[model samples]
Target: MKKSLVLAMVLAGFAATSFAAEPAFLADRHVARGASCESCHGVKAPAPGAKVSSTACMNCHGSLDKVAERTKAKVPNPHYNHLIGTDCQECHKGHAQSVNLCGSCHNLDWKVP
Candidate 1:
């Protein structure tokens, strides 16, 4: 029992340390990608016309259909709704932070009860 408890404690400590280290790894990749995120998202609020950005990124993302499949795990209507007005950074968060950044604009109207 004591041995199992100590092993669990050690694993938990490693997970905590790795979580702290994750941001640095993400930043390195963001730098290699060679663009400031703000060049796109901007201070102005997003609009439906923002679909332009999706088309631009998809040109290089290899297969838009594949990304749609993966993102649908987090967002159901990737084509018609979730990806419509938001910036790629709003949800993707590059390498550092992850989760739905769309809450910045969406928090008021969209919510789960």
Candidate 2:
């Protein structure tokens, strides 16, 4: 009986702690604001007006053109695959908290020195 009571208390405490943990998907401010690209990607959307897909971001930002010019060094085209099905928010996150987005793909440890 005593063991069971202690187990119940421990379970309740664990549940409370788990609920307090913050989820990564919930950290995006753009999603919270409801201004997702779907607003533009939806049916009857205008050209370059409603939908701002990653392809759109790449039309100019892709091929590392901008990054190369800025840093004078070639960078990987990380957004190419992301344009197929995901949004800018998939890896690059910003809202309630800031995170290291590019670091996910461009590992500093693997960078050619």
Candidate 3:
């Protein structure tokens, strides 16, 4: 009886923790692939609320032209946006949920990240 109770409690605890925490998908994926925070941030100690720059992303993901070429099949290719500058953090947020900033003005229906 005691063993059964303990097992139920353990399962409940695991379920609670999993349901309570929202995973940072991008950050977790990077960490899984051996990417440290400093690798993406490009600093030993980043400032509070400091954002990652597009140049930093380009350093690893290549130039804007290359990214646009890769996503050329997508409708209205996000990398080719002329209205807003290509800011990686604008859509590919590391710690928070990513958003399609273009969706604010256009009805592209593209999912960011």
- Among the numbered candidates, top lDDT falls to 3
Q: Name the lDDT value of residue 13 in candidate 3.
A: 97
Give one digit per residue, the lDDT tens place, for model 1 in 7-89: 99999999998866544433344444663444343424445444225544555564556665655655444434645655554
Per-residue CA lDDT of candidate 2, range 1-113, in tens?
Answer: 69999999999999887755534443233345554544434444345324345554455456444533554443444433333344654544333333445566657332211
Which residue pairs clash within candidate 1? Answer: none
Q: Judging by TM-score against the true structure, name the best candidate.
A: 3
- What digit string (tens of lDDT, one per residue) describes model 3 on residues 1-113? 69999999999999888855635577666766777878788887878887888887788788988988999999788888675475778788887778878888998787776
Model 2, runs deviating above 4 Å: 23-25, 28-83, 88-113
TM-score list, all predictions: 0.41, 0.27, 0.72
The 0-to-1 C-alpha lDDT of every candidate, in the order given, reads 0.51, 0.47, 0.80
What TM-score does model 2 achieve against the real structure?
0.27
Order of candidate numbers by TM-score, starting with the best: 3, 1, 2
